[model samples]
Target: MILHLPAQKIPIQEIPIDKKVKLFIKREDLIHPEISGNKYWKLFFNINTYLAGNPEKPYIITFGGAFSNHIAAVSAVGNLAGISTLGMIRGEELKGKWRENPTLVFARRNGMNLQFVNREEYRHKEKLTEFLQSEFPDALIVPEGGTNKEAVEGIKMMLNDETKDFDYLCTAVGTGGTISGISEFCEENQKVIGFKAVMDNSLEETINKLTSKRNFSLIDSSFGGYGKIKDENIRFINDFKMNYGIPLEPIYTGKMMQKVFGMIEEGYFPENSKVLCFHTGGLQGIEGANLLLEKQNRNLII
Candidate 1:
């Protein structure tokens, strides 16, 4: 798969926590520039199993929003793996203009058949699943955000032997698959803190149902929910890049880092605690988001 990554640690310098506390990022974003971050791990096994179990079933289908990193990753990987991919995009208005959004444009370039639907219809993934089953029955359907048992199983690889001892593991939550997978494997002494990019509590139930471990908690850093950004979030993303030289997209990692800083200011962690964060990449979405921001007359996430 084009999604392969080796375990590597990168430090987060000058985190506001006391001198005793140390923070580092797992740097999953650096794995592959395109098929980067948690999406790569989330899709690695799903694609493999689909091909191995049903060789004749050459098609795979999945769901995503307008600028979803999951859609981008799946499309990029499918092209590499010789699989026909279909994307059930979330807005009917996006149907005709592929040039408007960078993510949609990339997916189309990679040979993905983009099917756009109304927001009301896209809310229920089961409806999309039913449609896929009826129209293309043999297609392997990966859930939105790639959060499925197979994706969770693949994500377990992100925490290997070297990263077993940290006191805490931090990551941004989208569909909750990445954190759920890490929660299962993180040792009893280590806790996982997931900062939700979306502002709903629905993901909590889904995550609880997926993993057996009680080692994780979700924190709100949505900045008014998924894909919607406010002034503070924009300032934080830009300042963070200027300070640390790491680019974070508004959808996920940016909110997560913001939450981490907020918690540290509140003295959330004990002195001498060790934390490692998984950088779930969505840097590709920046271009598309900036376009929307420009229209809103909001500050671009430069």
Candidate 2:
């Protein structure tokens, strides 16, 4: 069963930070229930292509962190498609307490076989074939973040028939797969700016090796690091809701928008430059963020 979701071109709204500047959002967040945002497109075509070519392969295995949306999405979609899925999760054993992590809970409920691996082995996920061969020995291995060449090609379909005349195209960078794919499809005159959610130099090298586009630049705008948010980011999250009536989670889209606003204030973006921001969905994180906000409110009350 192929899931279909219409791409929404969210209206360009003028920023209160700068009245002269306009920001447009490509709402990939509203894509689908299981296949949300670019995650759907990234994994969908790759899985379909693999299955079609190799009908003998009955199971697919992938790797991710405990709270990874990719794992959750893959588990749900794979179950629906009648494919047995395995999730190699990074961390110590949490056999009985997996429900504490929402993504892990969902993945388990969707029939994903979970295996725990330490951080040391998880870092060497690129050589997953050896690990899987020693372990499952039969399942097809998918790279962490679903960032293979097939995944990049699948994500490129999201830009089909859209106007590519924008000055800047911005996206939240997780594994640099989506940005690298977008960079490949963008025109030479267009600039692709990626907001790195994690503080690391390796991601830049990864993207550089993936695409040969000189117009692409990855910014280290991570508010501290991956899954880490400061007070300033919380304020930006609040202001984003107030100004645009759109709620951005701190982990992904919030940081992207925060950096975009900061660049606008710093006068880094050229005047009257059309900016297109991609909203990579992570709505599951909202529960944790809201709980933190409530704790802060209670502290102020006390």
Candidate 3:
């Protein structure tokens, strides 16, 4: 079975902003309904490259937190490629009751084996790799968030002739693979701006490790941190959907868009400067995030 092709570039469109910075969203979100956006790019090469040269058929095993978009994407790819998928989930509390976790439930339905680990145990990747190698000897281990060299290769194609005219390349930074990939393909004059979806002081160096180019800068737009949201962000997301008809998940695209609008308002960009915003989809997590928001009596995303 063939995995969907990379470089599924969506039509570019301009959004009217007060500063007239010419902000255009390159809709990577529309690449696929389930395995949408950057996740698709991140997993594309990892699966293909591994399957190409391996003599022994192997199950795919990867890591992710409870609400991980990576887990869902890998599961879908495994189903498409006729490979068995195993997810080493972060929270041990979610072991048997996978159905209670929306993302895990979807993963299970897609035919992924669920293995839960405590937060402490999850931190040690080397140990996790050793353990998996011993148990699932035939497992092709895809790194957390699939940010390996092969994954970056697929992501580089996200920018091509159609997206070459933009002055800046922008996307939400997760494991830094997407932005890293984009930076490598960007022109010298084109600046790559990555807005962090999670707040971590160590992220700048983390992103640097994966990419050789120094043309990119990482900004903290993480509301508070990953999964944390402000009321204004929620309001902006709802209004954006009403105005543009493009939905954004609270975790990633929402925070990045909020930062972009703020930059425009503050004149961070020069007048008439063109910006390309990568719509890396995490819309699936909205349903689960909204559930938590409702229980906390916080303002919900539309």
Candidate 4:
């Protein structure tokens, strides 16, 4: 199914976090069902490129965590496209059972084959290309998060039109593929900034390796770590919803907006400087985050 999302022009609103700066959101979160936001463009490119080769392969294989949106998208899209999908998950099976997490459940329901691996093996995912090739010789190997050359190229098409001159083009950085692709396409006049969702310095190196350009800036914006959401972040998420009617997940876009607000408060952005932020989709994960927060609140009350 072709992912269809309303590409409505998201308003450029003045920051309530600070009055001097302005923020514009690219509502990619509302892109589509299953293949939503960047995931759609990311996978769209990869699948097209794979078909370009005209290989005899009938399936695609990728890696991700238990609750990974990439896995979910791949499974959903692959099923609809009549292509098989294999998910190499990073973590042990749930205690006493193989099934665990909503993403995995949905992936299985969508007919994706799942294989769990240890943390160490998962960390060496890049090095396991040979192993993966040997296992699925006829399958195309997509990098985790679908962050690859084709994925980057597909996403760049969204930024082709100049709606307005932006001082900084920002987005949440995960595997650095999205930012790297954006940075590569950015002209000398525009600065590309990425907010790290995970609390790891290695992201800089990862991005550097992805692209040779120094025009990209990486900020350590993770409140604690990946999937680590604090009360302040929850408040920000709520405030964003109340003020702009935008639902931002704490793991990615919420942290990015949090940093943007911080930069505004610190007078990092000049007065009236336009900032375009990309809302990479993963809204489904919000349910998991809310459930965890509810349990935390309940424990505190007890």
CA lDDT of each prediction against the hidden true structure: 0.84, 0.77, 0.85, 0.78
Colliding residue pairs in candidate 3: none
Model 1 Cα lDDT, one tens digit per residue, 114-226:
99989999999897799778887788889998999988888887887767867889999888999899998778889899888887779889999889988898888788767
- Alpha-carbon lDDT of model 4: 0.78
Ranking by TM-score: 3, 1, 4, 2
lDDT against true structure, model 3: 0.85
Task: Give per-residue lDDT, candidate 1, residue 302.
Answer: 82
lDDT of 2 by residue, 1-302 (tens): 35444545533344445545666777777777676777887887767766766656668898888778789878977778888899989886766667777788788888999988878878887676586767765566778888877777777765744537578889999998898889888877888899999988898888887777767888988877898767778787887787777767778889999899888878888778888888777766666556555766621100
Q: Tens digit of lDDT per residue, candidate 4, span 1-302?
A: 23433466433444444476677887777666677677887887688667666668678899988778889899998788778889988885542344536677788889999888888988999777678889778788999988877777777755755633788899899888888778877777888899998877788887777777788888988888888878788888888788777778778888899898888788898898888888888887776666666877722100
Question: What clash pairs does model 2 have?
Answer: none
Q: What is the TM-score of candidate 4?
A: 0.89
**Superposition error at 96 for model 2 (Å):** 4.0
**Candidate with the greatest lDDT versus the true structure:** 3
Off by over 4 Å in 2: 1-18, 133-138, 288-302
Could you estimate the TM-score for every candidate? 0.93, 0.89, 0.95, 0.89
